[model samples]
Target: MIDLLAPELKIVFCGTAKGTISARTGSFYANPSNRFYRTLHETGLTPERIDPAEFRRLLDYGIGLTDLNQVESGMDRVLNEKHFDLQGFREKMLHFRPRLIAFTSLTAARIFFADRTIRCGLQDRAIGDIPVVALPSTSGANAHWTRDRDHWYQLRALICRAENPSWGEEQKATE
Candidate 1:
């Protein structure tokens, strides 16, 4: 099982589940075609190309990864209700107390919370004080948003600001 490297993470990115490549390689968004890693690298969250085994590096950047479906392997292998545990997720969130929680896909956010009304981008409510942001899925299967530059930009901005609190506050003041 790909347990969270740093449970008390500052920021957490939750996906639907482990894909074939990620499950096999024991890393989040390990597939080469996945835009998650590239987005992080392009946004300057990571210094260079990161190995799948170095997933903990994300935690060093105040980031962590988890999945709604905690299945060992294969995204399709997850069950309907059993795989998506809302109560468990709530417990994890309460314990982790991250400042920001981002969902990689609208479907994942909706399915995990059983709230179809929540749309893409930042949500109104917070899990305690933590803000939640839902972005378009970066999976190759999500053809409609296969290369969503806007989503990437938003994510990059969030990460950049989080990594630099002063920059975020300055930008907010300017805005």
Candidate 2:
């Protein structure tokens, strides 16, 4: 139930709720099958792989984590509307004001977006001044749909573009 947040972060990864394994292990994205941590490294968002148990160390990498449904732990289908606190999520986003709020799953982003018209990459709208993005879930259960890591790379590209547009351009040239 603890939110790993701070001020002036480059990105904050938000999910619908903790999965059974994550809750039991007291670690965000603790399930070995979950690709969250691996994606972070693969996307160049982190210099090295990070253990779920050491999630707090993400702050050092300018990243944070949270959930839309803080009161429950399961897949989105099993969750009820009452479990989600969109207002609290808004408050948190406003308070922390991270450059980006990257929802770890499309389901979580839909609730925040208040509509089903969501995409798997950077959103057209921003939550206040902070940009929003809906990412494919890293959950193994959703692997059928979340298998593409291109979306993850797109996110990193966005961050890179924001931090240094020329840097992103150069990286793209090499690709």
Candidate 3:
């Protein structure tokens, strides 16, 4: 079992689980087809292409990664009941104390929270003091959202907020 170390997670991004590529590579969103790295780079979250082995660098940027289901290699491998783990996940959230928790997909947010009302944007709820945001999946399987420019855009907004907490509110006021 690959144990995930609870690094001082700043912004915890919760996904369903590791994909086949990620599991094999021991990295989150390691699939070349997945636009995760590209989106982060394009959004200026990182100065260059972040190698899968170097994902720990996200800690410096106040970012972290975890999954709702610790099992399952991919969405297809996930059983319906395995999609969420509220009790255990809450424990993790309490331990990490991230300033923000961004769900990589709407399905993940809904499953983890048992609330289907969440849309693909910032949520009003907080896990502890951590703000929550739901973003579109960057998986290649999510064709509707694959390579989605909007995903990168929204992520940029969130990253901006992380870098500057008051930026989001100020930008919204001007818009």
Relative to the true structure, candidate 1 reaches a TM of: 0.81
- Candidate 3 wrong stretches, greater than 4 Å: 1-8, 80-83, 146-151, 159-175
Question: By summed lDDT, which 10 consecutive residues of candidate 1 come out lowest?
Answer: 71-80
- The TM-scores, one per candidate, come to 0.81, 0.89, 0.80
State the lDDT of candidate 2 residue by residue for 1-175, as single tens digits: 6999998788899999999888899999998988888989988999999999999999999999999988899778888989799999999999988878899888899988888988788888988867788888888888655455578888776776556647756887999
Weakest 10 consecutive residues, lDDT, candidate 2? Answer: 160-169
Candidate 2 local distance difference test against the native: 0.86
Model 1 agreement with the true structure over 61-163: per-residue lDDT tens digits: 7778888888545654354657676777767887877667888888778886679887777787767766788878777767767445466567666655545
How should the candidates be ordered by TM-score, best one leading?
2, 1, 3
Residue 15 in model 1: lDDT = 80
**What's the TM for model 2?**
0.89
Candidate 3 residue-wise lDDT, 1-175, digit = tens: 2434364555677888788888888888888888787777787767787877778787777667888878677764455565457778878888867766788888888887789897777788877766788888888778778444575576656655755789868988999
Q: Please rank every candidate by lDDT, starting with the best.
A: 2, 3, 1
Predicted structure 1: lDDT: 0.73
Superior candidate under lDDT, 1 versus 2: 2
